[model samples]
Target: MPNMLLGAFPIGTKSGANNSTSNNKNGKCKFLLLCGGYILFLILGAAMFSAIEAPKIDAISKRVQSFRKQFLQSNACLNDEDLEEFLKAVITANDRGISPLRNATNEMNWSFGQAFFFSSTVITTIGYGRVTPLSQTGKIFCIIYAAIGIPLTLVLLSAMVERLLVPARWLLGTFNSKLGHLYQPFNIRLLHLSAIVFIVITLFFAIPTAVFAYIEPTWGALDAFYYCFISLTTIGLGDYIPGDGVSVDNRSMYKIFISGYLICGLIAMMFMLTIFYDIPQLNLGQLFTESTNGETEKLHLSSNNTTCYSGPSGLYMPQRDEDTRRAIVRIRPHGDDSPSPDEAPSSLNSGIRVP
Candidate 1:
């Protein structure tokens, strides 16, 4: 009997090994295909963007050259070469946030407030490109500073988002109580997220847009709004920056306030994204990575007792939820469509709940 069992075990083990190897091959193939598709997507985006904008760039360059010629012709005192050299000097200085124009009222780039603002933009990854390190030493320092600071900033934001999630979850609860019966859980969750998004826009984007437009002499309403949107998205297009407009009193203080605004606005934007990702239906990641047993990719966040936005598998929440106030919905058992009343609908079904 022992010999027969051993013989059977060998065959079974070999079959299981074959299955494991086959699964691994499939996973690798899927990963490679996904990567190839991503690269193609990037190429497609680049082509489209260039097609739309390359002509505009060419036209701008031609216009700039024409202007340079006009300027050289008008000013007889400065020859072409001399004017070119002077303009190059001014342009170089301008790129480093230094104003070479005699009448320019812009603050010095390395002044205490302006330097602090630049540092803020660096760590926040909102590299506006309006000011930049030119020296080799400064550039190297920037590389190291960003490498260390970006992750630290993300960690800080994660902790802030975790605590901020508490109130957001409570807001979900309020919605659930008010409209849990009238609509499906998913709809209520959508409305809840929408409400929070509206509030966030009002607080971080809309109000700030109004103030920036009011204070920034050269910026119209649209420009101020565009700046707010770009800054919050961290695109930092650099076309417009706060306190960089025409003469303004206390411009240094204005830059400092703008730096603080970026910090708070980013935190609020992250909180909004957290809420959006909390909805499992919106997790496009599940489509790519769900497994046969219904599990998918998972991440564990142990530090600060905080959790990231778990894509599709489960709550980033720990096995035992330590915080009662956090409204996390857990996945129900596979093949068990009917849940007991005590179980209530897990986060999977409702996308939100107390237990």
Candidate 2:
């Protein structure tokens, strides 16, 4: 009977020891599976995007080649030495003076307003490349300025977004109050996200596109919309830029205003992204976490020393002092030499005892 009692006491301990090793192995397996899944998804997505874009890319390449061949064959000036010399003279003229494409008025590219605009673009990572620093001194200044400015801009944007979250959460709370009884929490959260997305798109994309179209003579609605999308997304393709083709009445002021618009639009986009990520259903990262029930069980077991077992009522109960007494009585033998209840072995004491 003593041997049986001793054997039963170690059962929980042995299970716990086995569980620790199994938990570690399970965690490692989960990590590897997640990594492999991510790699596979990335490869599949790349292949899918390439397949979708390849036909248009090939068509554009063929058209560009044909245009180049036709232009070279049709133009007799290409075969003339005098024309070639003229081209060389034009290149040399660019070295002496500002490129005609940059500022036809011969105004300095390093003017304070233009420099400020350039700095904003660089720090924001827009890099339009329309007007670049031409001198060695200017290039060196740009490098130093960007290194400091990028972090400062990031901090400013993050602070602004953090404050913005106050109203965002309030908006979510309002939605919950209105819809909580009728809908699941996930659905209500999705609706809240949609509201933010709509506001961001209207304020940043739609309104800016309209304003840009009205201001820039060359840009139509579609062109302005595309420019706004590309700029805010930080793609910065540099193909279609405002205030570049034809000189306006106040070009420097226009550039500065565009820079301001870019900064605000980026902030709005960041806010939208933050709200989107806050919705756990949309976040793929939640997949890597353990289930809620399993996590709860692990946390409970780790914090308490008492063993859990089924009681007479078929409910699981932690083995506290009262349960320890019952276990001792069951394990006691019928011999007269057996110890009384009060003289039971100290090893049979509760694992967790209140003081």
Instruction: Give the top-scoring candidate (lDDT).
Output: 1
Alpha-carbon shift of residue 142 in model 2 (angstroms): 1.6
Q: Which pairs of residues clash in candidate 2, taking residues 3 or more apart in a chain or in different chains? A: none
Q: How accurate is candidate 1 locally (lDDT)?
A: 0.77
Q: Residues 90-142, candidate 1: write the lDDT tens digits.
A: 88878777786676776778888888899999999999988888789989999
Q: Report, for every candidate in turn, its global Cα lDDT versus the true structure.
A: 0.77, 0.73
Q: List the residue pairs that clash in candidate 1.
A: 329-347, 330-347
Off by over 4 Å in 1: 1-37, 75-77, 134-144, 292-355
Q: How many backbone clashes does candidate 1 have?
A: 2
Best by TM-score: 1
Q: How well does candidate 2 match the true structure in TM-score terms?
A: 0.63
Q: List the candidates' TM-scores in order.
A: 0.72, 0.63
Evaluated at residue 158, the lDDT of candidate 1 is 94
